[model samples]
Target: MEIDSKDGIERKLNMAQQSDFNDPVISEHNIYVCHVPVNSAFYRVIFPTSKINPYTNKWLKARFKKAVRMLEMRLPQDADSASFDAKKAKYIASQQQSTSKTSFVMDRLLAYEDIFIGQSHSFDAAFEYAISNIYLCPMMGSFEMRHLQAGLQNLQCDEAIHADTDSEFTESESETDDDPSPLRVRFVRPENEFQKKRREESVTLRNKVAEHSSWISLDLEKSTMKSASAKLNSLFSLPNPVDSLLKLRDAEHLVEETIVGNKLAELNLEDRHSLISFKEVRRLPDALQLKALFIKVGVISMQHIEELISFKIEHNLLISRIREYAHLVRGVWVIKSELAFPEDEYSLQRIVRDFALCLLNANLPVRRSDMQLAFGLTVEDFDFSLTTFGEHITSGERTWRLRIDGDETFGKTKEDLRVLIEEKRYWNRRWEEIHHYLSTIKNKSDFTVQKTFKRSFSY
Candidate 1:
């Protein structure tokens, strides 16, 4: 696979990682690989390194293809747009009915949940974060739990409550002054049955807190569960009510912390294991990416579709997370509406290319070397200069320059100097559409471009 030194995308790759500026004259052999650092919180939570199959990797790449199609379906042609299509919506709904990954989702969530509740390990990814977190509440991250537990430990406060001093806030108008009075009012105990019952519950709650504190902590290796429980019972006695209440509250806080901590820890552990299962991914055309590129795209059979789903599961955490929680998680991530990607080998190849280019639009500029490493260019007739359109526009009420890359780049001259000088955004929506088109082409077989990339441009 070789990309010509004149390719703009390749040029961008050359200068991006190696230099501080855009060095436009690309050399044939100067290829570059773009690596997005995984240390960021988003990447850490979103997509971590995983052992994925190469074939399945292609399906993950289909998300890019889907990105293109989603744009195409909603927007006007080549104008960077999207729209509502009731018919298309119905078609997507039909596809969702056929593609269900619920079993896999359930399996992964429970495994992770078990680990999370155990209170160990950090998380690299979270499949169903909201649901998982909500489910573990009262066990973790429950402010109410923390508050109640902390309150129970204040045995001195409880004794004070028994001592007949309580405060209330009241706003009153003073007879002698025009200004209202805002002061805390201290009141003596009423000595009523209601107050006595309230006082009793508070004491009981404090006791329960101590009983559960460190329930799972310690001595597992030193003693059996029965022995540990016996020891805990003996250790739990207090000299008086105050000491008892305080211990109970401390124990409650500890229990609350431990439970939540364990659950969070387990989620991280499972997510890490899932990443371990991810394989090296390559982009493939998915049904959604397909429908966006062309209406009458090539035929994709059920077998290939399965392969695509596998690719998505392995390389794409977004897809994997969905599949991991299929039991509770539904609705395609808007990118999985793959119903029309070309299924032919030649078309799949192009689809792969288009998908990669679509990623470029996302600031993930791929080099020709990447193309070779990924999927080689199949369209030998691709003339870079002719496939784009360059122009300027006013954005944010300010005059700006813009250049758009079209599909065919036919009969195009050199980069338009006027468009280049005036436009800040020079790429075209067609590039996204076309990039998806190229990816669709690559999904069929192992074909690649022969031109090498130059290292003098920025995407």
Candidate 2:
């Protein structure tokens, strides 16, 4: 076959087309071979259109025309079998070496065609042309190729079955769309005996707390309240003992006042003053104490001091332990200082900013009142100072926290503050536990003494 000439190429193509059905290869498997010269232009035209279809004795066609167009673009004039084999080996090795299951499955699926369309007219050229394109799978051994094809067929069958089931379900859902009633399933676990009892006790405790708010302090521990309520219920055999406890508390208060009065009369002036100071400080609430401290030291505005110290007192409640020369404002005592305020507005603003930052860095929320007390700033001056450093802080409901975004310094400081706060909380919890244990022990000791005294009297 002189394939160099156009006439000879045409003759070769015609022979391939005429023997398409009669040839053993074409009859059995629709395999058509069209021999063409290496440099012939007719090779491209003959290769794609000359192949016979297996099911129908017609021209073979590509399922994806886009893929065929791309393949045409990549087709090389001269094929290199060595280069093609090397590339194929590399591809197979990559598929085998893949660690990801998804990639391996995809690679296997790509290794063979689902439908057999016989061999390509130019195997080396086709392989070389599509080697770099990942969408195209390289040819594999006959046995592996056959296995992949079978697997693909099974997969297709499963998918078709699943698609039919889905269609049926969708149709049923459309039918139900018109119905007003909806079906719902709720999964619940029935409570056991212990859970039921616990739930009932919780309800009872809540009811008692709601009914008798005056009998017990709201700040009392939940466990302590529970135990006290249980004891009261068991001892008196009453559903509610709050009224009895309230009357007992009033009587105890009277007796305590009488004893304190007698002790005050017996003590000397210095000791009496000390006793009175201790009692006054103990009686003062935390909010009142903070106000007294601010007022006495003149940390707040002078205008606000008089209004803050509303409580009438005959003498100052001096706490010498807090400060040696603490000021006495009305009845409240606070730290005395001859400290000078900064004359410059900039300096005063700087002080407020520094203090606020320190609080934020410690993971403590900044309150306006605390800032005013710390810096001796009036409402106007405090607001002005806050406005000056507004970008660094974010406001909460009644407090402020550091805004760490975009600022490296604040970000690192916040992280460190978080760790410090966590450690402090851990220690605080430990201290609370120890205090609770000591309180329990003291209570047990007092009960034992009372029991012993009663037994002695009975004997």
Evaluated with lDDT, which candidate comes out highest? Answer: 2
Q: What is the C-alpha RMSD of each candidate to the true structure, in Å?
A: 34.2, 38.3
RMSD of 2: 38.3
* 250-350 per-residue lDDT for model 2 (tens digits): 65345444443444445432221133333333235533443333322323322333343434432223222223322222122222322122235366564
Clashes of each: 94, 0
Provide the overall lDDT of each model, using Cα atoms, as 2-decimal numbers: 0.30, 0.38
Residues 123-210, model 1: lDDT tens digits: 3232223422211111111111000111112223234344543221011112224343788656585568887799899889866654
Determine which window of 10 residues in candidate 2 has minimal summed lDDT.
140-149
In the predicted model 2, the residue pairs found to clash are none
Alpha-carbon lDDT of model 2: 0.38
